[model samples]
Target: MSIQLVFLGTGSGKPTPQRNVSSMALFRDGELFLFDCGESTQIQMAKSVLRPGALKAIFLTHFHGDHVNGLPGLVGSQTLNQRHEALDIVGPRGLKRWLKCLRELNILWPGFQVRSHEVTEPGIVFEHPEFHIESVALKHRIETWGYALVERDRPGRFDLEGARALGVPHGPMYGRLQRGEAVTLEDGRTVLPQDVLGPPRAGLKIVYCTDTSPCAGAIELARNADVLVHEATYPGGDERLAHERGHSTAADAARCALEAGAKKLVLTHISQKYVRPDIFLEHARAIFPNTVIAQDFFELEVKRRDD
Candidate 1:
């Protein structure tokens, strides 16, 4: 039940001398999910703790080259490595057609089956037993999306003494009671699940948003998230340029986080012009103190809020 995030590349547009591009990896329950695969993302993954073969799915915010150019390379390497498991690729509306063109041109040839899903409207796109995912349309030059991954609530703490006091045998019946099921003993006594279980524990929530201006949809998607990974593509004193480019300034990202009531904000997609990224942090920290600029190879373990 471990959850962690690794910023493989944090720079905007293209790879720079200091940063690679837009890419991040979220590993949960041993399955690795990618955020955006930019140029040389496989190489960046090799430099970090992510494994190419362990990739379960990839999520693209938009079709910008900086956000999705390295997809072919990564899939090819997975094919070369003899991967046969089905892979999922989720993105905006034109993604399916774009991938079709890539396949028609032989740009991407996977040894395994690949399923591409186009997210036209905003809602839950993927669901799993352990966790579920939601997406919302974001405002950008092109159609973009912000994602929220929320783990399911876990079972409450089991009281072993309470189970034994009910004269329940040390077997599957006791396990059933701990799992919130009613059990009956040979003496015709019935034991309820709540009698041996405490309150349910809350789950972890992580929201990721990039390549967009500060939008209401993004803020709604990140409401009360444990961690908000938003893009800060510009520093202060460039408000017009940021809006023109459909990007967010550091202050914009901070305002989004503050309005969303997010616990922590991690800024990525840094522009190369900012040789000194401290200014971005300074501007963001002015509004939100729990803010940090994400860098390549940055890793963080997202734990429960109570933890």
Candidate 2:
């Protein structure tokens, strides 16, 4: 599984010359999953490795302008790119109305198909052959959500030594044993799956969250995550601002990571007031040791490790 996170935009609400807004892309098995299509996300992604036509879905956490202003342009550009694949748009309330208005206003760009899903609860939203995505409702100014992508567990590796000892050659019999089946050879010898398979391996898990105050829902979504991408919209000592705006501070992000037992935490959606983003890193690191302040175009390699 090719699991990686591409930070397309890291800046918060306002756009700065150095950074854009809240946008992230999760690449897995040649498919690109977009989270929060902030303004200029398409332009930023065009310069990155992400191909617009290959986007399988767009997940919106909220309806804030900073989080979803780029939807029209992204959808329009996809149409121009001659993409015929259906796009899944999942979000909180009003998602259907927003897309409906877009289709009505931008009738010329109706070449592609879009399916809108209004997320109501916290559970698995989408599942495919590779992975399953779940949502957790967050406490924000609006009906926001945090997402967790859990990859399906793969079959255990074949045990060649065990198979050979059981008189099973490295052929179709070994394949059957690996598939958890009992195989009978021409000599009437039986081989069980346990004799030809190692221990089961865990799958990868990535958690993404933004635009919410420090809440238990966010922590629940991030529990035991391999890579956690949380919004740190403000620096330390800005608790008042964070509470007022339903945003999170650097310390808040770290607390979420610590509570969730995440292996690695990436802080993003930074406010524009601070010229030095290093300050956010310093504050976050003070609480959670394994923390990285995300930057635009920064890529993080994700791997699944047993605890």
Candidate 3:
């Protein structure tokens, strides 16, 4: 299966005419996972191909207004829609308290189950049968975390010719062998999956880091990732300003990707002062050739290494 990333809002701090704040939607197997619900995220979703009802989880990097101002409105809308599926919200320590405050104020009253996970310490935050997510503490102004979504390794390809040669019938027995289960033939011969399968294939890995300066956490999360979505809030010359604000320059983001051996780098969380992304792209490409500037509504497909 392929994973697609949609940049809903790429601007940092506040909305501009060309861009909104920080929000991104990751679509995998018909389910949607949101990272950072900035202001007007729902509006952006409406403009894009994303359906709010498909959203299964929301992950907050920090408590910054530009990162989470849209949570209440989004949840309220789901309540109005009478969504029945449970929703998960993951964030830093104050996440649960803030959600509770919203409930008390009637700002958010989702009829569906809302599960909140507060990241007191960074590690594996969420897990599924097919994939898992790991969180790492980032060097931001406040408590912040970077996340890595890693798909589990898939079974190897089945060798149809070998299976046929091994006296396996063209039926359920073939499927059992393909699933790594041994099958016994009518003649009392046992065939193992290893006898008719190639080596396992590695799964895709996507890392997302924002509102942080150059740090080990970002590098660790991005290690060997297929795609690293990092914040580039300032240009190369403004490194001091970027560091002071707990943000990264394009060059810093590129260096992180290079050190982490990431396959591709997507620069986002742009500052409003920049009218265009030409300089950012130039700076990052100088350090890492495989770098792209993320724009609002931009979509990227994270493909497996073999693909």
User: Which is the leading candidate under lDDT?
Assistant: 3
TM-score of 2: 0.95
Across residues 1-307, which tens digit of lDDT does each residue of candidate 2 receive?
A: 4588999999998778888998999988789999999999999999998878779998999999989998888888888888899999899889988888777786436586788889998899988887899999987998999999998777788877777787887678766777688998779978778777777777888999998899999999999998889999898888898979999999999999999998899999988887788889888999999999888999987865642
* Candidate 3 lDDT over residue span 1-307, tens digit each: 7999999999999998799999999999999999999999999999999988899889999999999998898898888888999999999999989989988988888798999999988788998889998899999999999998999898898899999899899999888887889999999999999999889989999999998999988999999999999999997878998899899999999999999999999999999999889999999999999999999999998878664
lDDT order of candidates, best first? 3, 1, 2
lDDT of 2: 0.88
lDDT of model 2 at position 76: 86
**How much is the lDDT of residue 79 in candidate 1?**
88
Model 1 alpha-carbon drift over 4 Å, by segment: none
Model 2 poorest 10 in a row by lDDT: 103-112
The C-alpha local distance difference test score for the whole of candidate 3 amounts to 0.93
Each prediction's TM-score versus the true structure = 0.96, 0.95, 0.98
lDDT of 1 by residue, 210-263 (tens): 989878998999999989999999976687899888999999999999999999
Error of 1 at 198 (Å): 1.5
Instruction: List candidate 3 segments past 4 Å from native.
Output: none
Point out where model 2 deviates above 4 Å: none
